[model samples]
Target: MQIPWEERYAFMTKTHIETYELVEECLKINYFGMKYLTEALLPLLESSDSGRVVNISSNAGRLRFLNNEGLVKELDDINNLTLEKLDDLVKSYLKSFKEGALEENGWKLPGGFGTYKASKIFVNAYTRIAAKMYPNLYINCVQPGHTQTEGSSCTGSQTVEEAAKSPVMLALDDSGQTGFFYDHTEITAYY
Candidate 1:
């Protein structure tokens, strides 16, 4: 999955209005790109006996990063969530973002990168929904720790190789565990 950190950095210090387009671009690359790619590959994936789709997510994507309790509850209710509702929730986030009311609406993050955080949150939610919808597929998302990469300005604590272990583990495992989040190699709560 593409992280779109160049766009993220450009808008880091700007107001939501000033960065609206960049934020939208990030969402298109980070969230929509993953969603569409998975959809397009579903047929082929279903043909395999052990189809797997491992989404690369982030620690910032945790539901606790979102101050909006209602939104958190909505996303966590995977059994009740639908694709349309999840899309609508993302639309609501963008609307609030455009209006410069993210903080007022409880969607703001502490050190900015709110768009990235929201995008990954949507990704995690989408992974859960897809896993439920397609029981035959082993779909999951993983937070490959903070690795040194261009997106992070090379300030992350872990090396690229170190950060890759968790995702690689998920991709190769045949545990039949779906619709869950992993922090490195361990299963964790979405919040």
Candidate 2:
């Protein structure tokens, strides 16, 4: 079967999953890992007058990729998006992975980026959810532009210097901005 390069490139990072470990790992680290750490640090963060919770997330996690109207409405409704509900969503996502039906279920364009996107989607959502839960905390998530980090195998276009600025600046900013997503240095919507 001679698949064209264009088609291959389109899906270079995508395909129906034959293994669930990759998705599981992504969820464990990207979403739950952040959640657990933040929970453990809530006391310290609360004690500080200018508490900042900076989650280094990726642009891949944005809500734009989601075409599922119902899902969008649910995640967007922070007041109703409880931790238990979010956990349920994660569980459902994993179920989709096991069934190899992510694309069919309205999660799209992930290609090889499926699991990362899946986990990050939650990261962004949780960032907002937590921020609303704790009004005083300066909780924000930033997409530190694609950088040539070891995690990306040094393949990202932006240099570490460029990427570092956004997160660092957000960390130092005492502007009381919370539950927002950033594209580099600019304040932006979660989508």
Candidate 3:
């Protein structure tokens, strides 16, 4: 499948402005979107026998800036742009996910695009932590392989249904593997 990149800022006044606006919108979608999934959707799913919760995250949420455990650099064969800042950001994400509070005063911080990324990162983290906290829940996140969707436009080789396979696979994972990340049928890690 060949999906075109969705033009998120088609109505923008200029190119640079459009780019910024699109990123902003992506951040908002990610933040509130995950919140909704956790608050509204997960409970209902958990009540079912074949309970499953799948979040369609992005490779962008992988946070290449930090290594696992938020320690040293995760960049040997990989890139090493801003591992320190990435660690801090990932820590903030984990903190929020484990606890929940981007702001003490109930507001977003300045330059919160990282927070958006952190929110996605935290979703996967929460998936893991929640699974540990509750033994019977099956929760996972899917990168979805650059699929074409309403927000993403059509900019990938996968269709919505095709990209949807990863989540679907996790949902049907009778083996009970929780907090894993899948890109269709394959299992991949984000840290």
- For all candidates in order, the CA lDDT equals 0.87, 0.83, 0.55
Compared with the true structure, what per-residue lDDT tens digits does model 1 show for residues 114-159? 7888999999999999999999999999999877898876646789
Encode model 3's per-residue lDDT on 93-119: one tens digit a residue. Answer: 445433545444222323324444545
Evaluate candidate 3 by giving its C-alpha RMSD to the native, one decimal: 9.1
Candidate 2, clashing residue pairs? 13-111, 13-112, 14-111, 14-112
Best by lDDT: 1
Cα RMSDs of all predictions? 5.1, 4.4, 9.1
TM-score of each: 0.89, 0.88, 0.59
Worst 10 residues of 3 by lDDT: 69-78
Question: Model 2, 45-146: lDDT tens per residue?
Answer: 999998998999998887877778788888888888988999998888898878877777765544467778778888988998899899989999999986
Worst 10 residues of 1 by lDDT: 9-18
lDDT of predicted model 2: 0.83
Q: Give Cα distance to truth, residue 45, candidate 2, Å.
A: 0.7
